[model samples]
Target: MMAPATTSRPTSATAPSTFTSSCTRRTDGVTMCAWRDSGTRIVPTSSTSTRCRNPATPTRRTSRSVNSATRRSSRRGSPPRSIPCVRCRIRNRRKSPPGRSARTRSRCRRVLSARRCACGIDRIRSWLTRTRCCFMRRCWRSCSLVLIAFVLAACPTKTEGGGGDGSFEVQDPLTRRLMDPDATTDERIDRVLAEAKPGNTAALPALLRVMRHRSQAAFLVVSDGKARFGYRTVELRETQKDTRSMERVAAIVALEAINSPVALPDLVLALDDVNEVVQNHAARALVRLGNRAGIPTLIANLDNRILQRETANRLLEEISGKQGFIADAGWAERQKGLAAWQEWWAGIQASDERLPIEGRAYQIGADAEADRRIGFFVDVVGQYQFLFHEQARKALIRIGEPALPFLREGVERARKDDNATTRAGIAQILETIDHPNGRELLRDLLTDASGSVRARAAEAFGNLAGKGAIAALQGVLGDRDPGVPIAALDGLGRIGGADALAVIRRYVPGEDSALQEAHILATFAASRGREQRDRTLAMLLGVSIATRNAAHAVLVRITGDDAGYDSLATESARKEAMERYRGLLGG
Candidate 1:
C-alpha cells in the first residue's frame, strides 16, 4: 500500500476469475483446522487498483461455447460474467474454407484424439496406483500379519527372554490351570500324571481319583506300592479287567506286601485261577507262604493236567522243602496221584495212534509227549537207571508189556534184514518185560553171533534167580573164555542158589595160573563183607606163599604191579563189575 502494488490477478476481459487463500506454516509443523458455515467475502474495488496481463487465456482451460453458455444461463439476474479469451472467440467464429476436405477434419480429430489419449494415460496410471495401494492393504490385513508374526517368532528374540517359537508357547488355559494348587481334581490329576515326575506329592490327586474310580488306575498305583499299606490302599484291591486272573495276582501281591500267614488261603484259591500267569504267580506265592498247609494243595496240583507242567514242576520243587509232604499222608496221596497219572498216561499211550502227537503229549505230561516220548522215557530209563530204578522198572514193565508185540515183530524184521541193534533192542525190551517168554528170548540171544547180545543175554539169565538160570550159569562157568566164566560166576553168586554150590566149589582151588585167576574172581563175586576180605587175603597168601614163577606173575597181574598186564587185568575187573551190576541192578 505504500506504493502502487503490482497485482498478480489478471484484469483481461476474457480471463476467468479464481479465489485463493494464503497460509503460513509453523516451524514445528502442527496443523490446525477450522470449521466454516457461510461467510461473505470482500472483493477488491479500489480505484487505484493495478491491472496485470496473462498470456494464457480462460479459453485455455474452458471452451468458448462453454463460457458463452454459462454467461447466457447466468444472465437472468444470475452471477457475474466469465469472459472467453480472444483465441477461443476467434476459433468460435471461424468457418471451414471452400477447399477444406475430410482429410483436414481427420487431422483435427487426430489432435483431439492425442489429447484424449494423454488424459486416458493419466487415468490409467492413477487406477494402477490405487490398485497397488489396495493390494498392499489386503496383503497386510489378510496374510502378512500371521506370516510376519510366525517368521519373527521362529527366530528367538531377546524381548521374549530367548523363547524361540510362540507355537510352543505355553498359552493353553488348561495347562495354566494345572499349575494352580487349587485347581479342580480332574485337571490336577491329569497334570500330575502328564507333567510331574514320579515320586512327587502332585501324584496324590491322581492317586485319589484312582481310589474313587476303583479301576486299573488304582491297580496300577497300588501295584507300584505308591498307596500306603491299608485296605484303602491301591494294592489291596483287585482291579484288572480280567477280574478272576487279576484277583489272583492282586491277592498274591498283597500277600507278599503283607507277608502274613493269612495269605495261604488266598494263595491256594489263586492256584485255581484260569490264567496261566495268575496260576503261576499263585504257585510262587504258595512258595512264599512257607507254611506246611500249602503242601497238600501243591501235591494235588502236581498232577493238574490243565496247569503248565513246567510251572507246576518248578512250584513243586520250590515248596516241597518247606511243606512236610514226604512225612505227611501226602506221600500216600502222591502215590495215588502218580498212579492216576500213570493211568492217564497209559490212556494217552493207547490213544497215540488216534490223536495228534502234540495233543496226546500235552494231555499226558510234557514228559510223555510222543511215540518219541516213548524214546525219551526209554532214554530216561537208561539215564537215571539207578536213582529211579523202581520207577524205571515199573514204567518199563508196563511199556514192555504193551510194546512187546511190536518190538517182537521189529526183531523178526531186524533178524531177517541182519540188523543187530534192532534185534538187540528187542531182546533188551523182552528182558525188561520179564514174563515167562523173557528167558526163552534171552536164550535165543545167547546163540547170537554178536558178543554184546550174548553178554547181555548171559547177564539177564544170571539175574533171573531160578534153577534153570543156575544150570545156564554152571555151563558158562566151565567155558574157556574169561568173559563167559566171569559173567557166570557173578550170575551164580547173584542167584545164590544151593543147587549150584558144588559146581562153585569145584572151581575154587588149584594154583594153575588160569584156574587160580578164575577162582580169585569167583570168590570176589561170591563172598561178601568179612568173607570177601578173607577170600582176598587167602588169594594174596596163595600168591605170596607160592614158589612158582607163573603164580608170581599172575599175582603181579592181579595186583597191578606189571604195567603191561595191569591194563588188561583192570579192564577185566571193570567189565566184570559193570556186567554184574547191570544184572543185579536189572537192565
Candidate 2:
C-alpha cells in the first residue's frame, strides 16, 4: 500500500526538525504537502511572489487539451507525481524574516514577468485531473481556493500604486519610497533627491505625480499671524502650501537635474501655477532646455513684480535677440516691448516652425493664433466697453510692428467712411505708442476731414512733440474748426519754443473770456527753454491759483525736478515753492 518504503538524504540534528510531520501518498499516486495536516504558514500572496513546496508539472492554459490529456492519463495508469520534504520548507517560508521585502519584490517581478506564477495553481489543477487519485481530486478544489487566498491576501493587485503599470514598476527602493503615501514629507523628498541621476526619466511620472498632487501640509502654522503693530507679522507661521511644498519643489528640481527632455511640457505648464516658486523653477528649467515655447510665460513674468523680472528680461533679450528692457518703465511703457516679443513668438508659431523641447524639434503651425489675436484686438480697439477697449488697445500695441499695418488700415477705412470715433481712437493709440514709424501715419491722420480726428492728432503730437512736428502743429492752428486750432496750440505749446510761444500768444483769449484757461494751459506747455519758461513764468507769477497750478504741473513734466510746488498748499506757500522753482530755473 505504501509502494515499498523509501529512504532519502539523512537530516542533521543541529538543523530544525522536519520529519515530525508526514504527508501520505494515495494509492492512485499523487503526493500532498505535510503543511496541510500541520497547518503551518507559507509566503503570503502580496506584491512578492512565492511557491508551493511540492509543485506539480505545469500545464497549458487551453482547457480542451488539458481534458484530453486527463482522459488519456487516466486510461494509461502512469504514476507522474512526486512528494519531497514539503513540511520543513513550508515552515521556513511561513513568515519572511526582516530586510527581505526588496529582495522579494525583485524576485517577484522576475517571476511574474518571465515565468509561471509561484503558487502553481494551474499545474496542481492539471495534475489533479490527469491522476486517477480520488483523494487528490477533492484536494484540488480546496488547494486552488487556499492558494488564491494567499495571493489575494498578500500580493499586489494589477492596479497597485507604484507598479500599476507592470511595464513601469519601480525597481529602485528610493524611488518606491518617494511614491509611498505614508512616508513623511522630508523622507519622501530625500528619496526623490536620491534618485536624481541620469536615465531616471522612468521616474518622471513619479516625480510629477508628487508635483501635481500638491496637497502636502508643507508647514504647520501655529498662528496665521499676530498683529504686533500696524502690520501683521506672519514670518514664522505660514504654510509651504502658502508658498509651495518642498517635496514638490525638490521633485521639480530633480526633474531638471535628471535633465530629461520630456520634462519640458511639465515645466511649461508649471509656468502657470499659482505658486511663484513653481513658476520660477519651471521657467529656469525651460530656459536651460533650449525650448522657445517657454517664451510666453517669461513674457508674462516680465511684469510680475514678485518674479525675477530683470532675469526674465535678460533671458528675453538673449532668446529673442530684441531689446526693450526698461527696468523703470510702468505698465503703459512695457506694453510695446511685451507686444514685440509676442508678435515675434507668434510669427514663429504661425510659420510651422519647431521650438525645440527635450532635444527634439516639435513644430506647431497655428495660423489663427497669430492672425486671430491681432484681428480680434484690432476689431475691439474702438469698441464701446471701456475695459475691453483698453485691453484690445494694449493687446494691439503688444502685437507691435505686425499690428501697425492693420491699425493703419483701420484708420484709413474710418477716414474714408467718415467714422470720427473710430478714426480718433486709432489716432489716440498711435500717440500713446509714439513709434517713430507711426509719425508719418500721425501726419496723415491730423488732416482727416473729421474735426475730432484732427483734434486728437494734434493732441497726439503734443505728447509726440519734437522739432520735426513743429510745422505740422503750426499749420493746424489756422483750420476753420475752433477745436482744431485749440488742439494745434496745445501741440505747439509742448514744442515750438519762442517761435511757437509767439504763435500761441495770438490765440490767448481776453482775460474775461471762457477760453482764457485753455490758452493759459497752452502757454504753460509751450515754455521749454529757460528764456521761454522765464517769460511764461513771469506772465503767470500773479495769476489765479489754478493758473499757477497749471504752470507747476507743466514744469514737472518737462523737467524731472519737482520744483517744490504743492498744488494743495496755501497760495503764499505755493509762492514760496515757486520762488524755489524760479531759483532752480535761474530766472
Candidate 3:
C-alpha cells in the first residue's frame, strides 16, 4: 500500500491560495463565499475561484450592495453575512457587452434595477407598526370622550333658576307667595288683585299661568222639581279649600284694571276658557281695552244664556256705535242685524281704517242714579225714532238685573195695548235675563193674543229647553199662523225627550210636506234607537215624493247605507228599491 500511494500535487491554474473563506446562504436561496486576503481585506468570491485570485481588482458587489443584502436577509429570516459572494451580484446584474450602444446599456440597467434594494424593509415595517398603534390609541380616546359627553347630555339636569323642590321659581316674591299651596285663598287673591296694577308687566307671566287652573265645581239643580236641570253659578269660598277659580277671576279682574294693551292677547285667549265666569271677565276686559277685535266673540255670545248675552250686547254697542239686532230683534230680525254688521265689517276692512275706541266707559254700580238712567232708557225704548229705540234697548240691557223689574212692567203695559213689537222686545229682554222667574214670564207670554208675541215666546222656550214648555208648544202646534206652528215644531226638537218625540211624530202623517219634513228632523233629533229607525223606515212609504226622499236621506245618514235607492229615480223604481231596503232592515 505504501508503494501504490503516489504523491499528487494541485495544478497552478485550479489551486486556491492559503486564505481563509466563509460560506453563507442568502434570502434568495443562493450560496455565497467571502475570502480574507493576505492584506486582511474581505473580498467577495465569484462562482469560480480564478476570479478571486486578483484581490486588488473590484468584484461585482460593493459594500453598499452587501449591506442591502444583509438587511433583506434579516427581514426574510435567512442567514446574514457581512458581505454577499461576488457570484450573486454578478448573476443579478445585467452585463452588456463592451462597446454596446447607449440605448442597450440603459435597457440593461432598467431590467436589473428591480433586483436591487436601497432601504431596509424590516426597519420600515417596525416604524409602521409603532405609528399605527399610536394613531389607533388616539382615535379610541377621542371616541370615548364623545360617547361620555353624549350620555351626560341625555340625562336631566337642574337649571339655574329652578327651585330645590324642582318647580320653576318666579322672580317676583309676591307672585311666588300667591302661588304657594299653604297660603290662604282669600289672602292670595287679595294680594294678587292689589299688586296686579295697570301696566305691571312683571306680574303678567305668573298671572297668566295660574288662569288655567280650575277653581270652580259645576253642579246641576232642579228648579221646577222635574227632569229639567238648570246650571247654578256658585262662588268657591276660602272654606271650600280649592280657590283656583277665585284666583283666576282675580287675575282677570287685575288684567282689566291694568288697562294695558299688552294684556290684550292673554285676555283674548281667556275668552275661550271652559269656565263661563272666566269667559265673561275676559270679554269685559277686552271691551275696557278699547279693542274692536272682541267684536266677533261678543256677536257669537248673543245666542248664549242671559248673563253672557247681556254682556255681549253691552260690549257690541260700546264698540261698534251701532245697535245689535240680536238684543231686541226676533230670530228673522236678528239675521238682518248679523248681515248688517257683517257688511259694515267688510267695508271697514276694505277701507283699511283704524277702529277708534269711543272713550265710552261703563259705570259698574246699581246705585239710585244708575237706576234712574235705566228707567229713562226703558221709557225711550218705545219712542218714535228707530235709532233712539235701539239705543234705549242697549242701555237697558247694559243695566242688567237692575232693569229686570222695569222690563217686566213694560211687558204688562204693552200687553194691555196688545202691542206686538213692544211685547216682543220686552219678552226677548226677559229671555236674555235667563232668570227662573223670567222663564216663567215667557211661558205665560206663550198664551198671548198676538201671534207674533206667541212665536217669539216659542223660540225663547226652544233656546231654554224648558221641560214645561213642551206641553205649551204641543198646544201651539195647531196655531192658525204658520209661523206659530213652525216655531212650535222647532221648540219640540230643541227640547228633545220622549214626549217631544211623540209630539213630533203626531205631525209626520200630515199632508203639509214642510211640516212633515220638520217632523222627521225633530224625530231624528229626539230619538236615537231602533224605534227611530223603524219610524223613519215607515216614512219611506209616504205619498209625497219629497217627504219620502227626505226620509230616505235620514235613513242613509243614520245607518250609512244607501241601499241602491236614488232620489231622482222614477216612482216604480224607487218603490222597488225601498222594498229592498225594508228587507235589509229585516222588516
lDDT of 2 at 499: 79
Task: Candidate 1: give its CA RMSD in angstroms.
Answer: 36.6
Cα-based lDDT at residue 247, candidate 2: 68
Order of candidate numbers by lDDT, starting with the best: 3, 2, 1
Going through the candidates in the order shown, the clash numbers are 1, 9, 2
Which stretches in model 2 have alpha-carbon errors above 4 Å?
A: 1-369, 412-419, 432-437, 466-468, 496-549
The worst-scoring run of ten residues by lDDT in candidate 1 lies at 355-364
Model 3 TM: 0.31
Q: What value does the lDDT take at residue 432 in candidate 3?
A: 57
Error of 2 at 408 (Å): 2.3
Candidate 3 lDDT over 490-578, as tens digits, reads: 67766777888888877643577577566665677566424555556656766767667767765675557788887677767777877
| Runs with alpha carbons beyond 4 Å of true place in candidate 1 | 1-398, 425-431, 478-481, 507-518, 527-587
Between 2 and 3, whose lDDT is larger? 3
* Model 2 local distance difference test score: 0.55
TM-score of each: 0.28, 0.39, 0.31
Residue range with the least summed lDDT across 10 consecutive positions in model 2: 228-237
Candidate 2 lDDT, tens digit per residue, 175-274? 4667675667677778878867876766775676556434321111111123211111111112234322566668877887887654543455456556
